[model samples]
Target chain A: MSSVVIVGAGLGGLRAAEALRANGFTGTITVVGDEVHLPYNRPPLSKEALAGGVDVPGLEFRRKASIEDVDWRLGSAAVSSDLAERTVTLADGTTLAFDGLVVASGIRPRRLPIPGPQEGRHVLRTAADAHAVRDRLRPGTHVLIMGAGFIGCETAATARALGAEVAIVAIDEQPMVRPLGAELGAGMRRRHEEHGVRFHLGHSIDSFVGDDHVQVAVLSDGTELPADVVIEAVGSVANVEWLAGNDLDLSDGLLTDSAMQVATSSAPVVAVGDIARHPNALFGSVARRIEHWNMPTETGRRAGATLAALLAGDEPDRGPFCAMPSFWSDQYHHKLQSFGMPGIADRIELVEGSVDGPCIVEYHDASGLVGVVGVDRTQELAPYRKQLAARAG
Target chain B: MTVKVFVDMDKCQHYGQCCFEASDVFELDEDGKLQYVAEADESRRDDIESAADVCPMQAISVE
Candidate 1:
């Protein structure tokens, strides 16, 4: 019987396992994860989980009894991999051989270089991190969020919802401008401002100051703000360090073909989710790493299908795997949804409603409409997304 | 055959992602609350399953 070893028991890893069974792969499957918790949803960590509205156990993707017949190596991280030997070494120094390997280790939260005790400084990537941040979000507590990215903005909204005074500091002219464009970002900024969240845009963090925990953040403009807690939502780094010393390209993420097959491995190895950087035909075949919520599901399906076919001694459908990327964020009753690659658009227009009100924004590049962003207008997004997908094809 | 759907309201955030996946089955009312057909045609099983898969909260299940 063939054996498959999957690293990172997150959404991608778990979904791939399900797909393996769905594809009739009657083989031994082992899922290794660093976290003790079973595969849980990460999207709620910044919103409902951080606001203390949901318990950690409720975030699990499925109940333990539903996981089926898979060797689960929880709380053990993959320390290294030997591609030639088709084996993986875990942090506990256990080695496992496999006929198929799926690398879905995902990314870790990026940290700030500022000097301060790590007691109160937080980054929301895990369930424990969200609980820690939630515990500190007492009413009137001042929070200094050091990035205007999705995680930062969503956390800001949650913090404010919890009655904490939140201030966002970022170098962008407006929060989320690089991805959502200036107009939408400005609109989102206005919404946050209306909710009493402060913004210090176009400013960089100089350093964090406190004895045992961050209490004050000094900006590069020499402006000092008193903060009870500081959150570093800068971004994330792909967990590809273990793939080092191997021939695999570890420049950005694990470089993979369009089908998510590892480029350097002769063995049947594939990657999925945030750690897999592959050519996206939607963006003119540009190799990019998508860290959105839906990526793991879409890519996991593809990777699992491909690996199962290879193990079954069959030729996998090697079509370009391009699924319309969609992501949604809920903040203080406002639902923000985006479809497609908005960052690459050259022009953006408000197709429906006004900037100050709930709206649908259309993003267009030279090739025409490439993306659509809707705020509290989910029903109006479908046709635009269909058209965008058709155009991409 | 009809597919039976169950949504754990405690886990559901009513994000409306399921609505996009299975438009004929899942709908978000004007108040932004999720309403769905308890018994959907088996033809929509794929769509309903996709809805369950795309749910960020993992609150939806089909049988």
Candidate 2:
């Protein structure tokens, strides 16, 4: 009859609840989320969902039967948590005590500090955000996307697919250069340019110019571009404000041990998904925060198992959480899949296929093969990923 | 015994992630469309189930 409380009823929270049950933990489970809606798939929010191809219900991860046993606190945000009392206070002024806690609060999109009435500006993080952005992407609308990251590029692609004129203002020299390296990132930039999307690379926004809403963006190099709608895809900040007084390492995110256990908390608390910045042995035991799609499933399983063991008064098994990080993106006609951390690589070698066609690129640093990025070549990338995972262990 | 696999085409993006999990059971055609065997030997249940788990769209199900 142990009681476990999980914050953030997104993919990570939902999967952690399932894993807790699957691990034979017959405990009272409670999940709290700020959104009123149930846990849904987020990857589609920037792709098919933004393109008006899929509805909100279609993005859900589970049906009623899948999560019927858990107590769901939808639309309630956890405002604060008392470590010594093992209690969480919600925004609605309700507090819940727990024997075990899982922090999967995830991240929120970072916004630019611009003065003006914030309208016609969008950030695709939630279902509502996607809906608002999609509604504004009319046939002749002009969209100015800020940042060349995954979200920005995906939003640009979706905007173009919906017959909207898109222009990207990225601080990076080329689109996705930091993540996919120069060659593949350039290839992707070329593909987007061929599809009628404009790129203002190596540029920063000076100011957002408009009367009521953003209509034009003035660049740092003294160029003003007309924009009907502005989308900020800059980056995300970890949602770790609730655990403020816990004395945990909050340098980047909720710092966890190799097992995802809260390193500084005396209480049994673990973190998972995008908000959990722990030592990943795959990247040479580097403490990194991965914001990829597959991280929740992998980290949630580990965190759930660890918490279940601690709650059952049994010592958890000892092993470095070495889940191979992988993520995929669909832009234009290319399905880009990447495994391992490519951003840390010093050299990128083209292993198979051509840059314009389906290809696989291997990332290597001083150590060895660090990662691989492939376009529509999942089958070819499988063996390499397995090999990389083996090396990680 | 036979393992039955089901994929909701409406949800499937044809990413071929399932094909990588269970190559013998699921295959993407020349046009990158997904094609799969309706039923397979029970010995391949683990492979098929892995396919169901790795699907990003959650379109694949096994019975």
Which candidate comes out best when scored by DockQ?
A: 1
lDDT of 2 by residue, A1-393 (tens): 899999998888987887787677888999999998888888888888888654767777753234578999999899999988999999999999999999999999998886654788888899988888877888889999999999999989999999999999998988989879888999999999999999999898888788888888889898998889999999999999999888878888888887788865467998999999988887877788999877887788789888999899988755887887888888996889888888899999998988777999999999888899998876567678777887755
Cα deviation at B30, candidate 2, in Å, is: 8.1
Mind giving the per-residue lDDT tens digits that candidate 1 earns over A232-321?
Answer: 888899999888877888889888887788866467999999999987777677788999899988888889888999999998878887
Candidate 1 retains true contacts at a fraction of: 0.35
- If scored against the real structure, what TM-score would every candidate get? 0.95, 0.94
Q: Report the Cα lDDT for residue A156, model 2.
A: 92
User: Which stretches of candidate 1 lie above 4 Å from their native place?
Assistant: A63-67, B9-15, B28-33
Report residue A386 deviation for candidate 1 (angstroms).
Answer: 0.9
In candidate 1, how many clashes are counted?
0
lDDT of 1: 0.86
Instruction: Report DockQ per prediction, comma-separated.
Output: 0.52, 0.37
Candidate 2 local Cα displacement, residue A59, angstroms? 0.9
In model 2, pairs of residues that clash are none
